[model samples]
Target: MTHDLVIRGGTIVDGTGAAPYDGDVAIDGTEIVAVGNVSSNGKREIDATGHIVTPGFIDGHTHLDAQIAWDPMVTPSTQHGVTTVLLGNCGVTFAPCKPEHREKLAGMMETVEDIPKHAIMSGLSWDWDQYGDYLDYIEKSKPAVNVVGLVGHCAIRYYVMGDRAVDELASDEEIEQMAQLVDNAVKAGAIGFSTSRVEGHRIPDGRPVPGTFSSEEELCRFAEIVRDNGGGLMQTVL
Candidate 1:
């Protein structure tokens, strides 16, 4: 039977901890119909001899939250066959932001990450102010890769404590508010939460990112939030 396409004569690494083998892959539209000695003729074909064919890669940690606004294809990683990326790593994300606070968050991302502050400020649509809305906006952008987001500590801390997030440990009241943010984010399809404790990841004014100075109690509160929300990942940069 005819198929949509076929890749013939390649070494296949199926990614199930299995050994590689030479094979032909039959395809129907976007779905792989068959593997191994696929005898079906295709409407199109490629001679893949000497090439390696494998399932696309997943990049587990990325900061593509800002970059996705301007570049939906999410290049470089896509060029390297990465089909999915986890964003909002290292506790720096742009959501849960107040309109007046956009510049500060962009500047902080620039200092901690190498992205240009101007680019982040100008390139994004700034359409969302909370974690759920942020995800919804990126969805409207029609990204080329699957995106899994982590709600970040910086945004939650800044949202709850404002500028004091950089230097002050959260008060009991502030921690409670931050807890609600995590719950909101996780319920909105955030796959996890991210935070940082390293001395180096600071904002523009020489202060470490918002979560950097948090007390153990505050950090644990956020973790417990993720845990109680049916349990998810805790990605930390130490």
Candidate 2:
């Protein structure tokens, strides 16, 4: 039977630690129907000779949050064959924020990642306030590749403590609130929580990012939330 499409004459490295082999890949509609020297003719054919085909790569850590706002194609990453990316690394994301504090997150990202503030401001609509809402926005943006996000502790701290987050330790009540927010974000769509402890991760104003000063107890409390929520990843840039 004929296939919808065929990629002919390529070295296939399936990424399963298997050895590479010269083969043809046949596709029917969107699914790969066969591989390895398929003899079937196809409606469309690509001469993949002299090329190696492999699975798309995944980037474990990325600061694509601000960049994704402007570039949904998630360029450079996509150009390099990275089809999946994790965003909101190093505790800088724009979600679970008050309308008044939108710029705060932007400034932190701008400072820590060197992303232009104006690009973030003009890129996309800041129409989300909850972590889930931001994920929904990502879905609607129709990025070229899959994206999983981590709820950033910097934005969460700023959301919970306002200006006090920069220098003040979280009170017990505040910690509980932040933990609950993390739980909410995880349930909403976040794959995990992220924070930064490195001195270099400063906000636009020269102060360390919020959560940088958090005590170990505070961090454990947040970790406990991830544990209690069944299971979710925790990312840090220390």
Candidate 3:
């Protein structure tokens, strides 16, 4: 039986905390079939004589929420061998938005992330209104690598409170609603929830992001939701 592809004579770093070793890797179809000295010849062969072969990297923090709208390849990350990227970081995302609030959210992202608003506005279809719908849109975008998303607190707060999300503390009822939204997002396949408290993370108007001033109770409620949902990550940029 012949293999589909073989990479020969490379230092393999398996990323398992195992020691690196010089070996050959054989691939049959999409699955890696074998490693080490493989006697079988492959349909395609690559001479990786002095190179290092390892699993693709996973970037834990990224702001590709807007960029991915236009560029499915996601640029430099893919070029550098990052196979997975976590988006919606620094508590900024574009989802759960109303038609009327589209520009507001886009402008917020533009201000905080420095991604051009025109590109975001023009490139994306804007067909989604929920976290799951956004995921579906991304799935159809055929990204070059795997994309994991987090529910951004900024977007969620803005969606639920409009202008008040910027300055006023959320009410008890509002906190409950926000908690439910976070729960829904996690169930909808969001890898986690993200928020920012760093003073540097602010919109162009000099106001901090929506979730920056959340009370401890609000934060804990969100954490409880994450814990109850089996397990998930929480990203905070402070």
Stretches off by above 4 angstroms in model 1 are none
In model 2, pairs of residues that clash are none
* Model 3 C-alpha lDDT per residue in residues 86-187, reported as the tens digit of each score: 998888888878787788778888888888888888888889888999999999989999999999898889888888998989999999988888988899
- lDDT tens digits, residues 1-238, model 1? 9999999999999999899999999999889989999888999999999999998899998888899878999988899999999999999999888887888889988998889999999998887878999999999989999999999899988888888989987889989999999999999989889999988999988978898878889888888988898898898899
For model 2, the stretches where C-alpha displacement exceeds 4 angstroms are none
Task: Name the Cα RMSD for model 3.
Answer: 1.1
Prediction RMSDs, each to the true structure: 1.2, 1.5, 1.1
On residues 1-238, what C-alpha lDDT tens digit does candidate 2 reach at each position? 9999999999999888999999999999868889898998999999999999777899999988867766889989999989999998988999888988888888888899888878887785999889999999888878999899999998889889999998899999999899989989998988889999989988877989899989898889888888877878888787
**Residue 192's lDDT in candidate 1:** 83
lDDT (C-alpha) at residue 97 in model 1: 87
lDDT at residue 205 of model 1 (Cα atoms): 83
Please, what is the TM-score per model? 0.96, 0.94, 0.96
Candidate 3: lDDT of 181? 88
True-vs-predicted CA distance for residue 216, candidate 2, Å: 1.6
Better lDDT candidate (1, 3): 1
lDDT of 3 at 30: 80
